[model samples]
Target: MFLPIGQVKKTGLSCHLKWFEQHEILPLYKAGQFPNALCARFIPERPDVLAVAAYDGSKIIGMAGASADTPIMWQIGIDVEKNYRGRGVGTYLVTLLKNEIINRGKLPFYGTSLSNLHSWNIAINSGFIPAWLEVETVEQENYYPCN
Candidate 1:
């Protein structure tokens, strides 16, 4: 299949929220992880928020969602399909998201597990630095059985 042209668009709150729940949120949930990423797409509308997708036809191969917590603070999360990885899609997605964040008068912030080198590289390429780091422990109460 040909690489789909990636474009950044301003999505409506209701439509974007549904997209997030289906395309982004479910992945994390299936991984036995809670929804850590802030949902920028919601009803009632948040003017300082933006939701981006890298679509190939009607399929969303990747997504980047973020919101401005304050005039100076913004946080972003990215998700790209496995087959689409290593093809610079994540980098493109984040770069577009960062530009949108900056345009809205906020500094972009991103975080990933230390072992996620691919994600780290993308963030660095997008001009972000580690604001802070921490190790997490998953106790049984929050654990899911490994298949």
Candidate 2:
């Protein structure tokens, strides 16, 4: 999905996910908590930028991340612990991240596997319309399920 640069709303919803800069979130992704699909290297040139994490005290239960696919376009992905699945954590964090991206003057979009209906729903709940399909080649190490 993609959003035209001019359509990013000036104001949007807020939430309690902990925000982190690209540098801060890289280590977490590398720590083996997130799977290969969510690894920062999945799309090397995309440049992971911001991440929002939801926690139960100090334990991270859910996370959503954004990467700059271009100067004005950013893409997002999410990961929620199995125990936390079906809850609203993913949607809230994604929505918060989307709003933050828009507030920062960039367009936010989400692309997910066709079989992953839950993820697609989260994107819709986060206000991302199904603009188009996005396909990209990935290294073997970046396409496996690593968890």
TM-score against truth, every candidate: 0.60, 0.76
Task: Report the C-alpha lDDT of model 2 over 34-136, residue by residue, as the tens digit.
Answer: 5512554645688788888888878888888888889898888788888987878777777777888888988888888777788878777777777887677
- Clash count, one per candidate: 0, 0
Residue-by-residue lDDT tens digits, candidate 1, 14-44: 2221234233443433442113234423323
Using lDDT as the measure, which candidate wins?
2
lDDT of 2 at 68: 86
Cα-based lDDT at residue 141, candidate 1: 75
Clashing pairs in 2: none
RMSD of 2: 7.3
Q: Which candidate is the best by TM-score?
A: 2
What overall lDDT, based on C-alpha atoms, would model 1 receive against the true structure? 0.57
Name model 1 segments beyond 4 Å from true: 1-48, 69-71, 137-147
